[model samples]
Target: MKIDTQGDTIRIYDFNAEECFRIARRLENQSLKLYQGIKAAIKDADIAAALDILIAEELCHLAYCEKALIDMGVDDINAEHLVEVVDTGVVTPLAQADIERVLCNRQEALKLGIALEKRAIAFYESILAETGNEQGRIALGNIIEQERGHRERLQALIS
Candidate 1:
């Protein structure tokens, strides 16, 4: 399955329950890498520490995605397989300009974090819309709620 993103719209092609889980796992991993990259680029100790906490949260989100895959009967959760399943370029919400802003200002980093969480929420909501399975919808809904919470936390930081 593949996700095509154009401007603010996302089109999902040949998506299934298993692919949904795989996509979630891939996005979580991407977000984790983004946080780590931002942490490395910033010199402020306080901002770095805050990013560390976000990194830990992303780790937990990744674990949840892995478990969701396992529960969906995916026996193998290989990183290489996930990469082949979906290209990161299509799913990544942050662009080079956003990353540049994040590196220069802590407030910009928080805004970027909020934007990423909003994108994750939209992705999960899209999955929920595509899914016919009750369990899958419930799972995706839960993930959307979590992303909303993350967005709210980031919003608070910016405020």
Candidate 2:
């Protein structure tokens, strides 16, 4: 299912509630992996420490998505099935190849973190706009607020 953003409205094509939860969980897991990769690659103690915090945040986000799936009546969430869901085209701030370059310095790492948080906030807002389920909307709203807080913390770190 493709999620299209046309002006102010978001169009979710042929997605059921279960599929939506799967997509969300998949995206969160991808982000968690990205943060973990970056944290592993960074050598600077300070940058590594900062990334450690973001890694924890991403893990929490992933858990929240999983909980949302369970709340949607999905008893057993198969990770393989989640990976097969339609690609939502959620972009990470730094690609795998670019991770080394972007995370070379503290400032750059913080900038990447800020960009990632912004993208996550936008993605969740779009999903929230398209979701008809009240529970899903509430979950998305909470996630968005958390992403905003992450962005603000990254901004503070940079400044």
Candidate 3:
């Protein structure tokens, strides 16, 4: 999934429930890859353990989105097919290519994780506000809470 950004704003136009879920899953996938890469590079056992927890959490998130899409009768969601433009001031997930470049050290990795969680939380909250479906709203709320926890965990590591 590609995100189009204009300055500090992102524009995602004509997005439906399935599209939203796909985008969410894509974000989670990106997070998973990022954490995995950092974990592989970091030699600190404690930080690696923390990243392991985050990796598991991201896996669960991806599963949730997959199930949500299936429940909505969407059997297959291809990341390549994501073509919506969102216009919002929320923080966007880091691009996949930036993963290696962003991992300079443990502290930087932790900071990046915090920023990633913040972006997910903000994006979910924005979607929750606009979602009309009861199930979709509930799912978004749950994901928002999870993202908040992720942010807190990363923040604690930074502290």
By lDDT: ranked, best first: 1, 2, 3
Residue 60 lDDT in candidate 2: 74
Instruction: Report every candidate's CA lDDT.
Output: 0.72, 0.69, 0.68
> How do the residues 1-105 of candidate 2 rate in per-residue lDDT, one tens digit apiece?
456698998666444556656666777777778777777776788778777777777777678767877877777787466334546676543466557755677
Candidate 2 vs candidate 3: the TM-score winner is 2
What's the number of clashes in each of the models?
A: 0, 0, 8
If scored against the real structure, what TM-score would every candidate get?
Answer: 0.76, 0.73, 0.64
Instruction: Give model 2's TM-score versus the native structure.
Output: 0.73
Residues 20-90, candidate 1, lDDT per residue (tens digit)? 66767788788888899889888987677667767877787788878878877777778456434455452
**Which predicted model would earn the best lDDT?**
1
RMSD of each: 4.5, 4.7, 5.6
What candidate 1 gets wrong by more than 4 Å, as runs, is 1-17, 71-73, 79-84, 88-93
Which parts of model 2 are misplaced by more than 4 Å?
1-11, 14-20, 79-84, 92-98
Worst 10 residues of 3 by lDDT: 82-91
Error of 1 at 154 (Å): 2.2
When 1 and 3 are scored with lDDT, the better candidate is: 1
lDDT of 3 by residue, 1-159 (tens): 224589998745434567667767777877787688778886777667767767887898788878888888875665355332332333344565555544445566666677778777877777677666666666666667767876887688779
